[model samples]
Target: MSIEFIYPEFEVIRNESRCIACRVCERQCANEVHSYDPERGIMVADESKCVNCHRCVALCPTRALKIVKSDCALRENANWPQSTINEIYKQASSGGVLLSSMGNPNPLPVYWDKILINASQVTNPSIDPLREPMETKVCLGKKKQEIRRDENGKLVCEMTPQLELSVPIMFSAMSYGSISYNAHASLARAATELGILYNTGEGGLHEDFYVYGANTIVQVASGRFGVHKDYLEAAAAVEIKMGQGAKPGIGGHLPGAKIVGDVSRTRMIPEGTDAISPAPHHDIYSIEDLRQLVYSLKEATEYKKPVIVKVAAVHNIAAIASGIARSGADIISIDGFRGGTGAAPTRIRNNVGIPIELALASVDQRLREEGIRDNVSLVVGGSIRSSADVVKAVALGADACYIGTAALIALGCHLCRTCHSGKCNWGIATQRPDLVKRLNPDIGSKRLINLVRAWQHEIKELMGGMGINSIEALRGNRLMLRGVGLNEKELQILGISHAGE
Candidate 1:
């Protein structure tokens, strides 16, 4: 055996007693892991290609197939883990940067898990969500600091454009090319039905999805691909994606193989050509430069659509967000280091940015200190796993939360972390026609709706337990949060006290 031959990470186990040899697994697996061994008169698997996506197991009529992590190990070393050793071996052979999909799998501290929400005890009583009203609805945009009266003593009701969400959650950006057309269709349909919004990543809005424009936030990234006046005007809002949490400083890259037909036409790029976004927007070098483009987009959209500046949560994110707020952006979306992406360099994805909890709290405190808290709305993302995370984020000062990985999971993604390969077995991240057809938008959208609605109900219940009947009251209410296992510094940055105190 070649010394360089690393064992396959997963093993496919077939139960001979239950095996019908129907070849259903072979036909369903896009990775071609299963095949019929005609001579042996049984179906066999080449486990090397298995991503452990569970597609075959789900489709097997006899339930004979199962994929399990191989119990393979090397000399265990704390300084050099098995995955690290294997990565070195693979990189030595491939001579290329390692890529990964989905969110960081590193064992970093999740602040949401460490923080506990406060519930009513004596003075303030908890409200029953079923018996009383609870408001999860949120509006994302600039807010007036004070009410002004006209000469006739009438209040000024004029305000800038805002995104009205039925729940304090919106589906984050997942470009069409990075995902499947049916996946985008599912998100668009679910967002519209739920009275929220979905971002059209850097990929241009597909012509077919123009009908869902009311629930869309078209993005303008460094590449500015597929962006035009019509594209900007077709959405409820516009997002300038300065950076993403997964690959903070670097831009995006969609392999040419995935860019075919509508993906090419929508991105306005030639077919079979790599779509590489520049690291920085050549037109934006400073905050002043960003302000110019922000105003320009507003002008092009006739000042009707709200402009959002989405940035990764980095070391100086508080200062960066303060600048964005002053740059006339109606909203600032912060993505933490754990955020998901279609693909990102493994090193950057694991080690670049800060947690969204720290970033959101610091930015909110900074804005409030500067008396510009109401200037622009705050939205945070990067691994908002459940309704509890949503509630904690609001208490940490986020006006709303953007969910990407969670939304994709609702549409049948197994988090195999192989999306960059463009051969998703679940039909959520592939461009192949055969694979794409596996996901029915009708079913996908319905599942997404169910997931979000369930979260909304939970959000209301959490709020009711806090004696807070509205999300607006929960916003920036750090007093309602307390840390459990966090250190003093983390607790300070998160603007919360210890659980006991």
Candidate 2:
């Protein structure tokens, strides 16, 4: 028995008086929500088909279109909301696990909003960034314990392979199969221009991007997609993808529909085949096994590039990171629960991992307690929204932060949460030729560069206000942060005190 239990989620409104039947909306929308009706000589819409990406609304030549959430509601019940009931109904019909895109949209506690930053007052006058020399440059890798002098009395400066960034922000991993080639090109160009790095997300580096290897971080996941000796050696650094924030314990699944053309070649997989990365690396059964892989990668790269171990933030993340720090990895990247992805199971994305703020604080404290904080650099990410979030993250103890969702937004993502549909109208997340062409790499790269450059200025201004001149000075300075509306337990977990304390 079929049931019509719910109304359309989004309603489209068109002003007939203002509309001229130009049909620009029809051409721009990839979801086919609008169609021209020759019989009525007017444009018509199917509201049920709309994801409310605002593509049609943005491209409407007559400025007569708008999308709004439908006001219709189910019987008011706090115990079971409409979304919960809808998911149950959907699963009953489809008999498959519900899939969601991007980050968790549930109303969870956002620690970043609850935490606050402190500025210098008359006691310690704030430095003006314009007149003072403020440095945002950061290096990601292990640092020497102490300076050593040779027998000739000359200093011996020995350091591990490090990735130098002009800013403390980098574009997080977004695979070519999940996003488009134009999107990858934009990140590559932006990273090059910004003197930062962009990750490949285990999809393997495209041949065209080899020239940007200086600003690239190639990833090797359980799938071992597009992995080769040359691929390992081509990048500034290599990352082992142990887990992802969106699907903490789950593996990656690139559907057959998206595995075509260059995607198949880059992934080193057959066309029209699903690329499934197993939950755990087959060869890794313990921490020692992880150490083996880390050293193997170092050997394969001829000890020239740093090896990073990335794991999702979880309950025992501090212990996990502690083990990884001693496992020969030069850097550790921790991802939080709110991290974005092209597709993830709804259950895992919403309920699996902890917040990055808590994880970063715990890991930093543990590493410091163990006296191994300098063994590896900590790069934190999941949802680093702005320069303020970056400042907060560094104060909470992150050498650098990754910006995934923000980078996508810079490339015109409307966050419709329909990236899994493979019909991204903005051309940032789709592989369809028509949709892909909508994004010009040249313009996209410039926009990305502009975003990072603006953020660098803001970061400098924030640092200046704190009376800090360099990122190294601000790296683990938790004293510059205070908590608001957070309980003692929350503040303790974040290693910060309540505001006005």
Candidate 3:
């Protein structure tokens, strides 16, 4: 055996007493982890290939399979963990950067868990969501700072374009090439049904998804892959993706292997050509340059759609957001370090960017202090896990929240973190025809709708508990939130007092 050989991280245990040798596990796994041993009259597994995605276990009729983490260990060393050792070995052998999917899996402080929401006690009575109306609707765009009146005291009602959402949640970007066609369809349909929006990552929109344009937010990244006149005009909003949370300051890369047929045509790239986006837009070096693109997109859309500037949350995010607000952008979307991606350099994903809670608080406070809070709406996304996170975000000054990983989970993604391999067993993050067919858009869309609807109900309940009826009232209302297990710095940055204060 080679000295660099690393043991499989997972072991597949098959109960021989219940094994029927049906070959169902062999047929279901795209990784080819399971196969029939004809001579032994039994099913066997190549544990080395297993990603622990659970496709085989879920499909087994007899429930005869289970996958568990391997118990093997190296010499105990607190400074160097097994995963770290494994990564070093892999990098030494491959001489390449390590890649990962999904959000950072580090045990960093989750501010959401540390924060607590306040409920009405005595004076301001709580409202019953079941009996009373609770407004979860949100409007994302530049808002009017003051009421305008004509000479005759008549109200002037001119307003810029805005995205009106029934719920303060939108599905975050997941590109067409990065994820399967059915996955995009599911997100589009669900966004339409839920009266929300879904971003079209850096990948260009498919020709068939034009019907969902009203509920779509097409993106223009450094690559400018699928962006064109028609593409800009087709969507309700346009997002200029300056950076992503997972790999901030770095551009995107979609392997040529996944860029087949429609993916190639949609991106306007030749087949089998790697789509590598430049780390920076050649024309955009300053906020002034960003303003030019924002206006150009608005001009292309005939001033009919709002423009959003999306950036990764880094140090000095407040200053960055302030600049974007003044750059003719109608909205600013901040993606924190914990945001999920199809694939990202492991080091960047885990090391770069700040938490969304801190970024949102700082940006909102800075904008308010500068008297420009109304210049643009604030949307935050990194790891918005549940309805409670949504409520906490709104109280911390977000106009709305974006969810990517949660939405994928609703679509049946086991999050094996092998999206770059393009062999997703759940038909989510794959381009294979057979795997893509596994996800029925009908079922996927319904599941997404159910998830958001349930969240909406919970949001209303949360609002009612706080004695707040509308999202407008909850926006930037820091008094309704308090910190529990946080230090003075965290509590200060979050703009909320410690609990029991």
Candidate 4:
């Protein structure tokens, strides 16, 4: 029952006369829109699949690319808008919600680019990463305030066990219901191989993923989706997602249509009804309430896995982080404004929260001021675009970095940001069988490992340049970082001097 309809009224036309064939457009495009065909001797494009990401257009060497809305007209229908009719036609032909994944792919300010990464030269002699011993591994959890020993020289009080990683980079939460089992498998395998952890976002972990439990981070988001005693105890750490950067102050809606069979049973909600997560945690009304949950998790897990309270970075985040520090949370994960989402409302994604660099600097400073910095470890994310950002985060006070978009990119996500539509063509974010099978877990996991491994070396190099070998030295080493083009108040808040000082 396939209905036939023409697609993409808009088409990109590359003028060959002005084309230099530099292949910049091919290299830049994530969609594989523009590809070189040496036999034809000109670049070729798949106009049908193009979502107008404009990567090719932006990188064209000779200003040769232009996207044009097709002027070809159909039978005019004044009753319904042209777009409305076209959408219905498109759906009739393809039968999907225009699904996309990764982040809200909009033209928003990327603070990481605005900020800069420093390398050592004359003032700070650079240690060669090739020869020098660089330590980039980090553990996220509460470190014992004071190690106690008995008068008889026997060790006394115990410290919490942490999720130890070979490097500071980790995979963020992607729920089973939202993503496929294969995708989860890929994450699990990669995490196990990389000696880092992968988060099970909200969705309960299947029995199959238990082999990777030592490297798993179980999350408890607002919906309390599939949360139970066994679920809590099965992971190395637990994360309570208070908010996400892409859609701060707003919860998410996993449409009922996608909830089928196991997904329906696993979530414990009826199929064909909207699976909505409320904005606020029903039990968490204050710091006291937060403490209750943290202790409850501790009680359930026998005080083994550390409890993490994740919040979106927003105004007064420093103050809020101060409260979370006192709330018995062993870790505080901050997601900045640019953090990606599966299906956050477009408006919320663009307008909510603050940048990670600013938020990280402020939260670290505030906690240090209160002398509670060691109470909890910090992990921040929201468009941590590259290894440089990861290095910058560590220098700015984060103990580790959580990467969502970058991980998905390793899984072949193009960052179209239309995830809510649920028709992701790449198969990385969608649940449909035909499309989901497109992603090979073997290849996806390898790419993920590749990304994190590259980042690890770069992070180490940055640490080496700062005359530091261990990541611990750079964790709160604000002196290694100097503010450039920042205002007086910002510089004061970040506790960094202006560059060249």
- Per-model TM-score, in order, reads 0.99, 0.99, 0.99, 0.82
Ordering by lDDT: 1, 3, 2, 4
User: Model 1, residue 116: displacement in angstroms?
Assistant: 0.6
Q: Candidate 2 regions off by >4 Å?
A: 1-5
- Reference-based lDDT, residue 349, model 3: 94
Candidate 3 lDDT score relative to the true structure: 0.95
lDDT (0 to 1) per candidate: 0.95, 0.94, 0.95, 0.80
**TM-score (C-alpha, index-matched) for candidate 4:** 0.82
On residues 1-501, what C-alpha lDDT tens digit does candidate 4 reach at each position? 235556555587989899988988776554556788999888888776677655567667699998777767677887775766766776777666543345655565554554565667788687877897888888888778787899999988666767788998889878887777778888999999999999998777887887888899998889987788777877899888898877779776788877877777666678777788999999989999999988888888988888999999999999999999999899999998877777765456666678778899999999988989989999998888888888778878999999988898788776656555555555666677766776788988898999999988888777777678898878877777776677788777667777888
lDDT score, candidate 2, position 405 = 98
Provide backbone clash counts, one per model: 0, 0, 0, 6
Q: Between which residue pairs do clashes occur in model 2? A: none
Score candidate 3 by TM-score against the native: 0.99
Using TM-score as the measure, name the better of candidate 1 and candidate 4: 1
Where's the lowest-lDDT run of ten residues in candidate 2?
Answer: 1-10
lDDT per residue as tens, model 1, 90-207: 8988899999999999999899999999999999999999999889899999998889999999999998898899998999999999999999999999999999999999999999
| Per-residue accuracy of model 3 over 182-256 as CA lDDT, tens digit each | 999999999999999999998899999999999999999999999888888889999999999998999999999
